[model samples]
Target: MSGSPPAGSQQQGAVPNPGSPGPSSPTAGNSGSSVLVHVAGAVVHPGVVELPSGSRVYQAIAAAGGELPEAAADAVNLAAVLQDGEQLFIRTKDQAAAVPGPGAQSGAAGAAGPPPGGAVIGPTAGTIVDLNTAGLAELMTLPRVGPVLAQRILDFRRQHGTFATAQELDAVDGIGPKLLASLLPLLRV
Candidate 1:
């Protein structure tokens, strides 16, 4: 905000460091806290890395040494931004397609919806719902699920643990045989 530019100042047009104080937006969410995160899968340096709490999606990718050629960079909602304790799954095309169904959970951008582990549908990028942690509305995002059924699933989860298998979705209140059949590919826990 100073008046005249300094002479021969080649750094005038340079990009500012994100770490430096510049413009702070009250609504620009990011934790000032710093934490170490493990970045793996298709990344340049697939290992443990440290980053600030509210770093952008791209910043975390940069700290991870950037994405590998096979990583689905386009799939991430980079501009929606990031949060602390978040996991980024830079999944390969083959890796994503191998899941029961990809692109089903579009409710939350940049949140991992595909499972990180091969055995279950992951929170790889979209809304990741823990059967125990989610409320009715949150649970409805799953395929073939609705408010009534989501509540049943929650009640069941409260009485029991996560559904031992997707088959147990049949036990939920409104989940009839046809609905359970419809949900086979989506219900993981």
Candidate 2:
């Protein structure tokens, strides 16, 4: 046991060496990283929350201190896997009536889906990405936009300011009229 720590015990006053990498250190090949999600609307504490990747929507809501008494939690599929930079909007009961919950009928009376930046469907499935708030990864989910185009869009936002409408994407390099048209249906400002 020479110079070795005693079984399940350490020398008194001994401290961990800061320069050394521990087994649980982030640099130790840990792939279970966290994702940042914006939990807004009707939650007790609405804001950006950092949760482990692959965390479910319910977990994000829990992180945000759970839903408010008026929150229509049933409107959102809590089991849905969350994506980084995604926004989870919890609508109130009144709001849910206008924007039909999960399996609610969508005829002349009920709207087909939530309004722009409203309730999110699955991760990047039917969610309308907000041009002013989207990050690189979320922007890449749009049609005809890869890493480079996404970066260009981000750069444009940084340079010019928030886009007033989806049509303003035409100002970004490589986003022609046709591409903008294709993305219009999926994007909002």
Candidate 3:
């Protein structure tokens, strides 16, 4: 009885049934509604950062690397309020894309097969990666795709539209039977 809470107090050692939903369960600002935010990129730490309401973009910048020398001064509204899930992009001065050169239309490498020794087919069946959402870096990972061909793939997708079928990649200048064969399994709409 000594371990029990006194009258009018909550019972000692009683576990609150957290699974039960009450009116407060689903309401914002309730005990279950607390959420912390993370900020990265061009900032001081470039890692997890917790912020409360009224935190500003400058705060995240300070948490990262205090901003790179080439980070656009005008890119971020230093005083702007940071949203809970916002990710800020600060471009660097040297991170510019150069114009394409000759062989920009060089054909795709034909029929990329499994690693070790190349073949027309892969050891395990291929899986598709979406071109629409994939970045230039990702497309470059494909076999025989030099930087130029990767850019062309992005440009073609942007000019036309998302690729529904993997076969549609044949539309890109460099993509041929060889390239398509390798890319087929790795593509998704």
The TM-score ranking, best first, is 2, 1, 3
Model 1 scores worst on lDDT over the 10 consecutive residues at: 1-10
lDDT of 3 at 180: 82
lDDT of 3: 0.44
Candidate 3 off by > 4 Å = 1-128
| Local distance difference test, candidate 2 | 0.59
Tens-digit per-residue lDDT, 1-189, candidate 2: 012212212122222223432222221123446667777777666777666567677766766666778877765656656767777777766666654222321112134333332333322346688898886545644544554676788899999999998899888878777777867988889
C-alpha TM-scores of all predictions: 0.42, 0.45, 0.36
What is the number of backbone collisions in each predicted candidate, taken in the order shown? 12, 0, 17
User: Which digits, one per residue and each the tens of the lDDT, describe model 1 over residues 1-189?
Assistant: 111222211131132234443222211114445544445556665555445555454554555556667775555444323433434556676766554443333224234443322211124434445554544433543554533455567678878886667787677766678666755654455
Which ten-residue region of model 2 has the weakest summed lDDT? 1-10
Candidate 1 matches the true fold with a TM-score of 0.42
Q: Which window of 10 residues has the lowest lDDT sum in candidate 3?
A: 115-124
Instruction: List candidate 2 segments past 4 Å from native.
Output: 1-32, 100-128, 131-186
Instruction: Give Cα distance to truth, residue 142, candidate 3, Å.
Output: 1.3
Residue 64 lDDT in candidate 1: 56
lDDT of each: 0.47, 0.59, 0.44
